[model samples]
Target: MKKFKCGVCANTVYFENFRCLNCGHALGFHPGRLEMAALAPGRDKRLREARRGPSSPMVYCANEAHGVCNWIVTSHPDSGFCDACVLNRTIPNLADPQNVRAWGDFERAKKRLIYSLLRFGLPLDGAPAGKGPLTFDFINDAVTGHLDGVITIAVGEADSVERERQRQAMDETYRSLLGHLRHESGHYYWMLLIEDTGRIDEFRHLFGDEREDYGAALERHHVQGPPPDWSLRHVSAYASSHPWEDWAETWAHYLHMVDAIDTSVAHRIEPRSTRFFSGTARAIRGQDAYRSNSFSTLIERWVPLTLALNDINRSMGHSDFYPFVIPEIAVAKLGFVHRLIRESTT
Candidate 1:
């Protein structure tokens, strides 16, 4: 979510930009460096870099041919997709124009999730022998969207109308393509790091025992909804359904908060408090979120940003961008996620 610019003209650009808006130079993401590079012609169809350190020979991922990916392969000499794209088990049908657009949105959101995970040095093993990697299935079918080892994203979820309808039906404050990807991936990582590893006891103590009957719990949740005082612990109403849901929902919000601070850092969006310790708001700076070990700095940045954004949204007669509150219990859960991710990096 950091700011990107063209290496050729220094013009502001977005992560999804294929070519510089001002310079018209082709662009590709260098995953190794965690930066974007402007592209120049090279041998065959290969390209020579122009940014993010010295210019080097590189080629776009094969998915670029279909306009779905912007990442480049950094190691292999032969042309291929980047490490993130290689996990693709099933992509949407590209022949249809609407499917192609929906697939593009899905890829963009997926890449954002992968990018953040990689920035934290999380392991992303390649697609396994036959089963698949932490793969994705962007399907247009009757199957419910979920993750049972492989992440599934319904193509209709990409449509703004359909997404909004579903969000309203579920009475969620926030929902998006990125949110779905992050939440589902949370389930995948929970099994990988918590269940398979030895963090089960700690996880259970914080999020509750996952041994709870998921089907019945969910059934009760949908029928009765979350308790009125659910915010005292769970991040969302859906999170109150079960221990597994609590972990995934909390994990997704952790991603949301961190990513938001990252963008705030990249843009130098810092908020300063005027009063001393007697005041309510905490002081926060853009750089603190990325550098500080404690969640205090990140939460300090998050609270004010949410406040400002929510007020601005009201001016435009729209719903709050982040309508949820983070009480002490939710903060404790987020701190656990923070420690786990940082520990993995070390």
Candidate 2:
């Protein structure tokens, strides 16, 4: 995420900030401008830019009433929600305070996911005209997965304790709400970019035949487990369950790498001079990973940076910041995703 500052007082602010700490100005993110704005109150729940005055009128997204969104939409007859909130088809019951808090976590992660999608110039509400519109459902007592265009997230996943328990039960090294969102979104985009665009032949070559019986693949995966050599060819063991899963897992990792590289660039973070880190320092020095057309450049920058981060995490006695490795074959799959996204945007 890009670093933000208060437009009124120039003090640093964060993406989720609703009020500036230094100047006490109300802050709202303008989705179109892609920046946080310092706000001054206007008539009838409207807000105007703090520094620029009342030229542009804005209103907080309706989700703001629940304290889950801090984004603003244009003040107009048809605009009441920000670009991100408009994608929600259902939310957990807000009457329960526990559900309210958990849903807040879901929205924060979902917004970050949406922010990355926007940065990639991907369509949020179903582009290419004929495809189903992308939407989200935050519900209770259901498995988290994607079907058609809707991504369903189990509300329990927002509870850190329950999420960790599920991760352990599944024998997974890493899992989070954002990870779930990115992975499910990968499924949605596969339908759009690969299936809809008639690129399945290319996808089959890299990910194997997605035509394989998915239910059988998953059942066999659970009973027999991934092949012993899974890590050599896939980003994670679960990815080996089916061709579609391989695509989604690899796609999620691609997003992870891009977002990490983008944040590193935004904060000007660089690897230090050490035997493990010296080789990659120059690769990331001035590059913007999101706009870079070279997939090789992203991997070059990502590897050493992750190594350094892993070491730092060890110093703090925390788990590795990134726990997975990208093998050569996985790199090829990720490259396919990179090209697919670039082609869609161009």
Best by TM-score: 2
lDDT of each residue in 1-346, candidate 1, tens digit only: 7899888899999988889989889998988998888998887877997644555678888989889898889754453768778777787767899999988988999999998887777767523322224777888973534565688888999999998998999888889999988898888777666765577888988999899898999999999999898989988999999988888888899888888878876887655643324566555544635445876667666777788778889999998979898878888888888888877668
**Which portions of model 1 miss their true places by more than 4 Å?**
51-56, 75-79, 126-132, 142-148, 273-283, 288-291
**Per-residue alpha-carbon lDDT of candidate 2 for residues 1-346, written as tens digits (9 for 90 to 100):** 8889999899999999999999999999887777999999888868888878447677899889899999987533375778888889888888899999999999999999988898889987565646787899999998899998999999999999999999999999999999999999999998888885678888998899988999999999999999999999999999999999999999999999999988887788856423333543343356667777988877877887798899999999999999999899999999999999998898
Each model's backbone clash number: 1, 0
State the displacement of the C-alpha of residue 66, model 2, in Å, after optimal TM-score superposition: 1.1
What is the TM-score of each predicted model, taking all chains together?
0.91, 0.95
RMSD of each: 2.8, 2.3
Model 1, residue 305: distance off in Å is 1.2
